[model samples]
Target chain A: MSTSTNVRLAGLHARYQFVETVRVPIAVIGTTLFPTLSLLFFIVPQSFAQDPAAATAATAQLAVFAVMSVSLFNYGVGVAEERALPWDGYTRTLPAGPSPRLVGRLLNGLAFVILGLVPLVLLAWLLTAATLPPSRLALTAAALLAAGFPLFAIGIGIGYSMSTKAALAVAQSLLLPLAFGGGLFLPPETFPGWLNSISMWLPTRAGRDLVVTATTGVDLPGPTVFVLGGWTLLAGSLAVWAYRRDEGRRFR
Target chain B: MEILARTVQATRCYGPVIALDGVSLDVPAGQLLGLLGPNGAGKTTLLQLLPGLRRPTSGTVELFGGYPRDAARRRRLGCTPQETGLPPTLRVHEVVEFVAGHFADPVPTPELLEQFGLTGLERRQSGGLSGGQKRRLTVAVAFVGRPDLVLLDEPTTGLDVEARHALWDAVRRYHQGGGTVVLTSHYLEEVEALAERVVVIDQGRVRADGTLADVRSLVPARRVRLRAPDLPELAGVERSNRDGDRHELWTADSDALVRQLVTMGIPFRDLEVATASLEEAFLALTAPGTQTVALIDGELAR
Candidate 1:
């Protein structure tokens, strides 16, 4: 008789197979097409640069794609689709332990961290003025991760909580505004007093400022880390809470 | 085959609609025990609980000797739920191999494909398979572990009679091999053919638990069929509208009834008797408004 084991080997097989299946779509939507779309964030922002300070605001606005990929599409849609597959029901029935099922699959969340950065890194390098010096590029990448934390946490969190349609709704509603508010497309400096104050702590704003500060050797350290760190922790905590509190039902 | 699959006061709720109430049952090894219940009668919930696909809201469920969720406990168990949703994109072999990898020693993909009558269809994607093929595939997966205990929900659901009977042969062989099976289905024929014992539930509670004979005994087993001289209406006899001058009556004492018919020499062309099968008893046990006990002890069933 064939024997049984509780190891989560099925989960690993599934993840690899999933990646292979989606590799083409991922290339088309995430790589080839995303760069072209990334260029479109600047369509309405040239005029914002009419004011000198708005240059910083415009940088923030342009960086929106990176954060969206990391936080929303990566965690949200990716996770929800996997959850929707009947294979998930298979996972539930398998002798595999939950820890094993959980570990190998969540790597896709980290993959989003990369998808989130591609455009912004591309955007930063395209503009010589915005490029981080080679000596500081590693730190900038680190800053991007820190900045993307809240968004990443929020992405996977909402992905777990909402159904496929609801996740799409949330991703659509939150994407542009998070970018707009964080100054990924526009300069936070040009915001009204209160709005600028709020932007100082927003994830997109913190990411843009940190990247910019790292590039130009600016003294924006103190508040930049705080804003990014705070959002990361808050979102992470919420995401974990949502995950733990889940009813464990395998449905929308 | 019987199994020792047991639950202790297990209860579950899907956001307030109670799925399983306080339920407890023990099925022995090497016998096929059927859970006969109508929809929403908590059969699925009970199966899900035993397989650890769900946690009991208020109590514990045990598979074999340990907690249901324990990996070791699950390793020896096989489960097939009613909704046999196979991955549409996976080729049949990929599905088997994937599940096989989780087991310490899984059935060979080729052997399984052959065993399930999918010999050359291993490359076929699950979505493209017919309904009967899908059920066969599900059966193969559940047996992947070569488990000692198998929980089958609606086992013969989509199979034709020939296919169902063939599957029954496999189940009987499994039992002969000293494995246990617990099944739940609406097809009483499947249950009668395979199950050595049947557990009937209604509205989240087990209404009856015993061998088919014990269940048949709950309601009389005898069904009187005889040729009467004329259409003499007898009390307790159900009218047969067929062109024959025969009548039928359901009862427990077939010999006594037959003797009475003969001793009286009642004007009848022919007379005979038979006991009720498990179906009538099951129907009576689960019928609405008749209070039946739950968590029965063996001695009490007699």
Candidate 2:
């Protein structure tokens, strides 16, 4: 097939997948609402809402949580559930190959991630002291996209390697710990010295720091980029390996 | 005849258990071939090989004169695995269209669904369809791309009588259009009704492969039922069962058995002689310890 035909087909597949996912309202509602609710109940009622710097940093941290939660559940639990379906196996046998489906799924997840950010952005702008210049706002958008890569990879890795039941448990269990340890739930400055040192290396911490610096004009530390890059490489490798293992286990 | 797919000495082993052992077969274009086998007789394994879903352990499988694993080569091939699921949330038409998008020239979505008896169900969610409807849809999806060859494994497994006939008509129409089909079924009547050629597989090997008549003749054991009391031993009778005063005898030579009964002055009435159905022929061919043989030119040989 020609390259253009392949691209068009991928676009079609992505649209259908997006429609299928959103038709189940709970999936969209849960992913988009949780982070926005956190910002409303916790950050909006606190003293941080009056401090421009603290409010912006807090919103960026919550944005990291929003992006990570959606990426984890959508790729991790979603993929594992699909692997058990007969339709998924049938599509693999088609001559068009796996690219269309993979690309479509990734694009669908991207749409939801963007949808999730909307409410949080609006709430922060209205009720809190979270303010960003046009340039800084653009930078934060780019930074959030960059941080999503490792989380997406980790979701895919867990999804392909585990059964549907196990993936649900793993994704759910991993979510809170990663969020808390990476200082997404509370400020990293409050951590004990050793905990503070350990939190900086977590992918969530790396993602949080990157987004916070982008939104608040803080200087990004030297290790932040390396930490996110390292996690991306490691998680990407795991995703690929898990996918291959799944294929071999089923079709071999 | 042009061969669309072929496997040469293809064998597949799942760990220590052998699912197929050194099986070789060729699929000719424009022919409807039926694979008949008991459960666990490797029928599914053989179909899986043709579609490149699984690789043979020690042999080669080819589709459209190329490696079966090549994605481009499968463009002309369509297959419905034994079990499949349709995305629950998508409408029936949407599911069909999504698959049709992958092909260079696909049959229109409306026409394909109508052919499969799913016309009015365009808006129905696949998950909400009845079992029979789901089965028909699965089979219909195979014809969407107008493939030259279609592989169906137990295509009518869960359909009611009416639904089965509908599917049969669809398959017949496809075959009449010069499409090649290779289907496996436990239903002897289904094979008899559809296949131009039959292959009986058992214990991971082919015990018979030929025209229906050729296979029936391989085990020419006719069933002879008669109401006879106190009948003497007959020379040509292979096996005999008695229920009250009725006796059912199976023999290769019913003519000789009847002559012996008459000549011995045995009083027999209500005699019934029935030819073997494909089910009996299938059972005789696949019976355990029966040496494997191929029928060539209406003659059986090892």
Candidate 3:
């Protein structure tokens, strides 16, 4: 009826979705574990950890990767699985409209992204010479979260357009390439000539450069903000298109 | 009576398959209407149109005298589709409460659960509940918003007899309290039990629509059951099916058949003549080439 009530209902939906996923625990553990383990085993004991700037940059890059992975899997695979259920149909027909449900899902994705970062951040602090000032740490968190927008949009688009099995495979296939090609797994400085040039325009690369800049004071050589913003706009449009396509096919 | 929902020559197509073909109907306020049809008889499709879950390919569907797609109008409508899967991880109470939150004034969650006989399972996860319990919960959630109109698509489909009766009782209570309900079921007995008004649908068309008695009168055939050592061909018997040694004959005039049997002095024993049940009436009405359109027109004229 009222806008306040609608907002409250959205909050309730978010809480319900969050609780539903948290109860399973395995999904959360699985998404967050890989990045944390990668940091611990691969980056911590290496000579890179001895270099403060390199370790800090690597830590920030992995943290962004963790957020991207959670967003893609949680939104993409989760939405596809939900669409297959009758409960989703019931909710869609409710008079509350799609805003509350979409907002609730985004909130759930945000919660997982934050949860996914905790382990990585803790390992980076305890095991490596990586360091960030309190201000830079806060800025880096904001930048990493901002970087998740495109990933979330992409995930939602995939979820709406594909079946659960297809969404899972597609998200996985897209995740590794984006991470590697965007210079998340390796520093962009070490990337070969072609990849290094291509990585500057990729969303994942834009996200990593934004986070790295925020944390390490590295001046971005390319238009990092424009690249990230462009991807966000494109992915957002794709997400909206996918949702309408699904609704048209299923409900109309 | 005020009409709560109406469909005028509505037709729906799913790819090449026609689900609801030129079906016209009206649901009055406070009327418990039963849609009786076999599986894939377009009952679910019609129900979905009323709640704005699906749009018609042609013609129009209206709720509260407005387009069914209007969200403001749909706020007063509630529906349960044929298959509902609850989120497995949430406890039953949480699910109920979450759905209830969407309404302006929702019934208390515990009271609604009690009404549906789900009080004891409030703490259990929905996935852990039995199929019957889940069905009951699904039906109960449809009433949480205290909607003026509720559409239930095969609410007791997978429930046991006891569960079905419980759901019927709950539905009867709601109807008595002045709630309008339109439910679909393949079970003729269910419609006879719960609906004051019955609509029989077949091949995506309304073959019969009227009060139960009115529908029954459309097919006036009486069933005659008898056993004999040897049987001769009967002239008036329209159709007959054998069950063991007894033969069940459907005839338009049972009295004439009985009188003829007496006059002919046929050696027949254990003779029985009875009015057709709703199931038989439905079969006769839906039987191919039975002039269903004429029968429906005749009923509407009265």
In the order shown, the candidates' DockQ scores are: 0.28, 0.61, 0.64
Best by TM-score: 2
For all predicted structures, in order, the TM-scores are 0.79, 0.94, 0.93
Cα lDDT tens digits for candidate 1, B28-132: 778778888888999988887887777888877778777766676778777662334676667888777777776777878998777778789888877789998
Worst 10 residues of 2 chain A by lDDT: A89-98
Give per-residue CA lDDT, model 3, range A49-106, as digits (tens): 9888999999988988888888788899999999998888888656676777888888
Q: Which window of 10 residues has the lowest lDDT sum in candidate 3 chain B? A: B293-302
Please identify model 3 stretches exceeding 4 Å from their true place.
B81-84, B228-247, B250-260, B294-302
| Ranking, lDDT, top scorer first | 2, 3, 1
**Looking at candidate 2, what is the lDDT of residue A111?**
86
Give the alpha carbon lDDT tens digit for every residue of B1-302 in model 3.
Answer: 98999999999999899999999998889999999877888988898888788999999999999987666777878777333478989899998888888788999998999999998898999889888888888899899999989999889988889889989999999899999999988788899999888888888988888788778766556999998655677769887888667888888899998888778888888999998888887887777776545345335531
Error of 1 at A42 (Å): 4.5
On DockQ, the stronger of 1 and 2 is 2
Q: For residues A1-252, what per-residue lDDT tens digits would candidate 2 score against the true structure?
A: 667866887898889888788889999898888989999998999997989999988889989998888888888989998888878877766776667778888888888888888999899999999998898878998899888899999999988999889998999999998999998878897899999889989999999999999998899988999999999999999999998898788887
> Which candidate's lDDT is highest?
2
| Alpha-carbon lDDT of model 3 | 0.86
- Estimate, for each residue in A14-115, the C-alpha lDDT of model 1 and write its tens digit: 465455345446533662345336444553335533443344334434544455554587567656665676556556666766666555545555554455
Residue A124 displacement in candidate 3 (angstroms): 2.2
